[model samples]
Target: MTDSVYVHMAEYLANPGIIGLAQSPGDLVITEFMANPAAVLDSDGEYVEFYNNTGSAIDINGFTLRDDGTNSHTISN
Candidate 1:
């Protein structure tokens, strides 16, 4: 199994990085996500985990899981 994440930030998102949100609330939005391949029988496996890179809390159970773009799992919060 692998863990994937989706984050909701109340501001702008930038690539390569962003700056100038020191005194403003909801001025930056950043989400950290990752996914890895599933394990197979008799084979070495890799899994993915996600970390929150912002000052916020993420509700993981509210997300759904998919394999090959097909519905595989649905998390209930």
Candidate 2:
């Protein structure tokens, strides 16, 4: 994604309340991130788990994952 988009996302993720979407009650939470494993290489074993504390399902089609400000992977449906 472009730098502007990255900045926007970073801002949103950092404080959803800026747009009035606070994390109170329920929200998608990153519960775990496994970076190493005995059964596989770290690259292959790495995984992130998210939990939707809300009662309904969440649509994460355009969500993005970034390890740093300059790089990102967008989730595609």
Candidate 3:
């Protein structure tokens, strides 16, 4: 990883209504993110997909994933 990151929004937030794959630096990338509303459920499931958009492999050993902005859960690399 060159300390760069990429973030692709789900189809719901686009003009054409489709997911986009934008690549960026890993250092500036966000560890935790969300999928489009269509793919993400509302308080139904207790799990979310944390995509590694670094364009390379990433090790998320001590990372945190939160849905309600308060309670956070950790995932292994």
Candidate 4:
């Protein structure tokens, strides 16, 4: 079987207003990615795109991404 990742919205952090988040499986999807680009540097080339399957727009603030190695990142805005 294949592995799958799930995305969930957070309802915390001085949220001034209601921001929709992934409520269940399949609520978010990796729509596109670019591991390598013809030009530009790796920082400007490698990328991943996510799509919201829900009706409302979801806020990705406070989200975190990491790998088995020392690579990690968090969305602050």
Local distance difference test, each candidate:
0.39, 0.57, 0.42, 0.62
Ranking by lDDT: 4, 2, 3, 1
Q: Regarding TM-score, does 3 or 4 come out ahead? A: 4
Candidate 4 at residue 65, lDDT? Answer: 56
List, in order, the clash count of every candidate structure: 0, 0, 8, 0
1-77: candidate 2 lDDT, tens digit per residue: 52222212444575565532324544777777654477885468766687877766655655677653565666668
What TM-score goes with each of the models? Answer: 0.33, 0.52, 0.33, 0.62
Candidate 3 local lDDT, 1-77, one digit each (tens): 22222333333234332223333444225544443346555744433545565455544444444443345555554
lDDT of 1 at 6: 38
* Residue 9 lDDT (model 4): 36
Residue 40, candidate 2: alpha-carbon lDDT: 88
- Error (Å) of candidate 1 at residue 44 is 12
Per-residue accuracy of model 4 over 1-77 as CA lDDT, tens digit each? 54333332345344445547665667777787654487976667777689889888877876765544456556677
Q: What is the lDDT of candidate 2?
A: 0.57
Candidate 1 TM-score, true structure as reference: 0.33
Candidate 1 residue pairs that clash: none
**Model 3, backbone clash pairs (residues 3+ apart or across chains), number:** 8
Q: Candidate 1 residues 1-77, lDDT tens each?
A: 65434332223233223232222333323333234435455324533355454465544453344555443444455
* Best model number under TM-score: 4
Cα displacement (angstroms), candidate 1, residue 48, comes to: 3.2
Give Cα distance to truth, residue 55, candidate 3, Å: 3.1
